[model samples]
Target: MKNLFFIPFLFLVTIASAQVQTGKASFYADKFDGHPTASGEKYRHNKLTGAHKSLPFGTKVKVTNLANNESVEVIINDRGPYVDGRIIDVSKSAAEKLGFINQGLADVKLEVVDPGDGKASDPGRPIEHVAVDENEFYEFEISRLKPKGYGIQIGTYQELVNLMRLADNLKSSYKKDVTVQVKVINGIKYYGLILGKFPSRPKAEQFREELKKKFPDAFIVEFNRL
Candidate 1:
């Protein structure tokens, strides 16, 4: 809930996975139910289908709510979410399962579980495909750190005001030590917010579940004692 400096959900997951995309996601409107989609199939509200800017019509993608870590596998059957900063548009049912139907927009990570035929879903709608690197972002790799215990990274921001604002709020609300980690890229400075010093990975992980209620994208980090 800050400025869209391009960086999205603040969750870190370790796994053997596909190219993960971090961005904002939205659900389809109820009015579009039963309407014809780009793939020539009718859009059903209950179907676990979604629209991507360029993935083939039948590609299966796993969309994860970075905030809450909820995930849903949906088949790509349309092309859209034409709005800037948004990565995908899922069916209403998928959105409900992902637990973001009420918020309408959720910060998410997308993994292409299965690549479908590399053919256009809609000839009428030209593919405005953007490579993963083309995504706008403010987060950057930090200089090596020698933190003691583990930490939880909540979010990163281009605006120090936003970063500090969140840090102050989180510190007071959670009663934890807050740290602002800085990194510079192309002369632009970015800040990463971290909550500190959980004695062990398991301790940090146990606390992570509680923080997810508010910062769904929060993730564990190493060398956080610094």
Candidate 2:
């Protein structure tokens, strides 16, 4: 039960946990502008918004570039940096403020100044990962139960605690099953948050359209050996 502490930590994650991290940070490409973010808001290059691997969305974080000591505050609105060593992704403007737009990536330290208000997706003090207990968190195993179907992949996360927390929250709020599918990408362990089981691509696509209001990046994935 390694990370089972998350079971009780759910109610207080916003209050009890104050995480800090140090890693590489990159900014979104110009193409990402106007696309729907994980928080259901349009991605704007000028906005002070960013994406994190596992901080609650809507939380504010202070990003400091170790090179020049330049810093900027951004609101967490998405998830990512599946890139091997990156920890956070910011908007073009944020990168400019941090003085790293030309560098593409910068060594940075992150500190969470505030937690989310139940929105989309961190901070830094050097915390490596969120805690999650396997005995209690792996309950949403949709692969073996409905292995052959179309599932909507809303998000993919590194820490199981982040995946578990979102899955539990969705199941309770939407009153629908949110499946957890474990996979390994580029030597990294990740858990994907999937919603609904549709029999066909058209059906799944339709559902995805409706879900887009909440999850703009939602995409359909076929569940095979998954």
The number of the candidate with the highest TM-score is: 2
lDDT of each: 0.69, 0.69
The C-alpha RMSD in Å for every predicted model, in order, reads 14.8, 12.2
Which regions of candidate 1 deviate over 4 angstroms?
Answer: 1-18, 119-226
Q: What is the per-residue lDDT of model 2 for residues 150-197, given as tens digits with 9 covering 90 to 100?
A: 878877666555555555555555555566676656665666777777
lDDT of candidate model 1 versus the reference = 0.69
Candidate 2 Cα deviation (angstroms), residue 43:
0.4
